[model samples]
Target: MSLEAQYLANKLAKGFVGTNQIESNSRLCMASAGTGYKLSLGADGPPGSYRDFEKADVFFVIGSNTADCHPILFLRMMDRVKAGAKLIVVDPRRTATAEKADLYLQIKPGTDLALLNGLLHLLHENGHTDPDFIAAHTEGWEAMPGFLAEYPPATVAEITGIPEAGIREAASLIGRAGEWMSLWTMGLNQSTHGTWNTNALVNLHLATGAICRSGSGPFSLTGQPNAMGGREMGYMGPGLPGQRSVLVDEERAFVEELWELPPDTLRKDGVGQGAVEMFQKMADGAIKACWIICTNPVASVANRGTVIEGLEAADFVVTQDVFAETETNTYADVVLPGAMWTETEGVLINSERNLTLASPATDPPGEALADWQIIARVACAMGYEKGFSYESAEDVFEEIKRAWNPKTGWDLRGVTYERLRAGSVQWPAAREEGPDRNPIRYVDRDGELSFPRASGRAVFYARPHIPAAEMPDDDFPFVLNTGRLQHQWHTLTKTGKVARLNKLNPGPFVELHPQDARELGIVDGDAVEVASRRGRAVLPAVVTDRVRPGCCFAPFHWNDLFGDCLSINAVTSDAVDPVSFQPELKVCAVGLAKVSSPRRPCPSPSSRLRSSTCTDH
Candidate 1:
């Protein structure tokens, strides 16, 4: 172990915080916290079961290449496609998954809300809405029509660059389909209006009554394997394990009891900060101590410079990872060595709510320990020995399942570790029915289904077409959309270690339309400097016809590897959606300039010969 790792281990042994084991008999205990219908857990009201992905029939994928990011479960989507499911892909560039899609809507960056609202308007006008479902299950339906009235196809076409006919066609496909799903990834979440983008998609699903059933839902594909699991365990701000929010008194009491702590001793009512707020706090010095487990915020979060600044400014920072060297760990006061995915025993909840286990295929590297073990030891030191005690991951899983079980409907009374050991089992697996778990939930044999609402109906949230947080203009002429490459993962933390993977695509490059490249005198393999109000980076230009004019695409995976170049996020805005707080990394205004020479004494005869010359002319 490195000196930093030893320091963290020593601290944990001294007892700073208590670790509590979470067990579950019903795999449903692992559901994500937000964007789902609210449910009651007998004595406590936990957040509702999320159905956005699980219930989708016709899935509209905008800005996400799930095939590359979440490869394992993405096969389920491929199966659905082969079964003749309708897939709509909206991205500036045609990606691998887009090649297999039934329809690919190549839209400009930052225009998602306009395109989504246009579809909703068309759905409303075409008489495709389920009035019965709206009247029974929803509260905000009446406000939706009024809100959508402003986003006509022509107006949306002008903003999004998608033809009116395409908008109408997409609406027709979604409205006529038996069930529809809308799935998005960082493309939608990393934008200034990311939360609004998520809310807008949910609005469409609810309006059409397409949620909470088989093959119909609005799902947000998580970037990390344990992103969903983290939420379930209340690792995020303002959440408790089992979908319980921190705001509720009873919910807080339940966790307090689970931890065997007095209500007065535990923090009762502080609002949990999101990623953005957390970093902001770090930068401003309000949050002096931060322990980052598993995630690398510096490389992954938007504005790499600012994220690093925040980390450096922190009074104390702790990072737990298997790797000795990481971008985030470089700034840590102490680093704890934790097991890698293949070297740990834990559960991961995928986009489809499918629970899978990662068993220890190999022993951890030198001095490295399982994440739970480290956390449990810390908890013991913090004086929470009763809750932190755990002999195995199975013990944690068992307790989490019991917490999720109620005496009544849809409880997980039947599932056991023995069954899980047999194979990966979907949630809601009752003990009595050996392996007959509910693969496709909320649907009746007759093909009709009811939403999981008090009235058994799905309500459409009337979401208006809000403008993007940032708009392209003369100063920043191109819309810069940031995303991942085919082989690379987020921030290049682990994936960067593999030589073969790095060889496929070595460094970051700006993907541009042929016309834009020609107009800017940007040749393929030519280095170009992309700049925004926030920051800038010089990268190679990959001219292709895949992207439309007036926009450019860049990957978010490069840092330190290539000239300490600024990350695309450095130029991305921090404007967030009101609901989800997801940043708008999908859309931002930027300008590109080709780098002519390594060292230039004076301007050359060719206008393009000057590295700093503006390419607009």
Candidate 2:
């Protein structure tokens, strides 16, 4: 048996059974806050209610690729296309999602803040702001117009490469849409300015009163199926289970009381370093140890070469994953084989805040252990026996739910393990008797809508448009954007093992506009050297007009198996967004050159000819 499975089996042998079995439907009825239940009144009954290709009056796609990455969701958008819904794709490149958009606003990389500011300006100028909503439930109203006044459509158009009319139209569409929803993924969050980007989008929705209702609100599409659960379980840095930050003294005290830890043992107000900062600290020898679970930092982090150095520099590095051959595991001092998602009974929270249970379909292979079991054991090893003495995944989940439910208005007593196992429930399932929990939130009992902030008011932030930390200049003329391909998953720990999936896009290739390719003396199937101030990578070039001029895109999934090539992140800059500390993976300046050596021969001529047939540019 793999080490991880063996660990799980041992835990089960020690009398760990599933905790609080609740039906799936019951779980869906609960809310994250555990108080003041949510209600579903319209078409947005449940997260699964909408599918890909479904017609939306106005489709605002920010940082995500609905097609290649989320094909199922993408199909729903296609449904909308057939129904004549206007699709507006905002991305750094002509992604598959962008290609299908009715209007593709190919903005300059990492300039989302500027683009959003311009949209806000247009909305205010055209008198599209919701006056009643703003007066009733928002702060910072007076200072907003002054902040937006500096970002005229023409200024935004100059920086983002979007036409003035296009900017105006996009703003007008969003402002006037009867039902609108905004979808964003890694494109917005995986940047130095990720937080700012998120807040900017939220600012617009708040300005026009477009959130917490059917076909409305700002949705942050998580990358992993269980990333939401991870956040719920306090797996994120400096967070307690149930959306509680560790910085709050009351929250910290509550958690410490639950765990019975001494005041000094638990962190007080320190925020854990973000991904990039963590690695940089490790590289600098500040952080002595790291335990990586379910993620491959070496292949996924920007400037991957630096990530390797950080791992190498760590005094101890532990990698727990289902596969033994991940790029991260190769560098680990100890490789703990972990159970695959299919081999474990757990829960995953989706983008819509719906919690779904994943039952184990098969027994684990070898000694592979479940993630929770490993964590428990580690906790025990650290001498927190009582706190970590959970017998099952259910028990751990119960503790998490309890932590989330505070009696002082944040009660989630209705959602027990028994209820969750029976059915999926939206959060805020405080009153079991409350009118069939909200499908749409922030709407009061009297049907009056509002924001969810402390004062029941949305705060409008005056965010300025800042240029990408790294810009194209004489040294690096091409802007590089990194993202996913249709077939490959993040870091390729599991997806890489599937031969059929690997066949889709076999290796790393820089997608460039035909004009730029010609200018650089590059052709289809030609190897190219892409360099930046941070690092450099060599990959095959697929010259095509599918991409816009002066910008290039590369998928982040390739590694040695794809041809010993460095990951695209090798050259990505480590600059972070000021607010969220997210690395700026969306935009960086790079210089590309044709590889002259025949040592790496181009793909067959037929391959080049076949690739040329699909150009829409």
TM-score of each: 0.81, 0.83
**Candidate 2, after superposition: displacement of residue 36 in Å?**
23
Top TM-score prediction, candidate number: 2
The residue-by-residue lDDT of candidate 1 on 108-207, one tens digit each, is 6777888888988998999998787667556667788888898999999998888878888899899999977677666665555555566677777667
Q: After best superposition, candidate 2 residue 77: deviation in angstroms?
A: 2.6
RMSD per model, one decimal: 7.4, 8.7
Residue-level error in angstroms, candidate 1, position 609: 31
Candidate 1 Cα misplacement greater than 4 A, ranges:
1-33, 36-58, 70-84, 405-413, 430-436, 440-457, 561-563, 570-617
Misplaced by over 4 Å in model 2 are 1-56, 405-413, 416-421, 431-437, 448-450, 570-617
Candidate 1 local Cα displacement, residue 28, angstroms: 23
Worst 10-residue stretch by lDDT in candidate 2? Answer: 20-29
lDDT value, residue 571 of candidate 1: 25
lDDT of 1 at 76: 72
Q: Rate the local accuracy (lDDT) of all candidates.
A: 0.59, 0.60
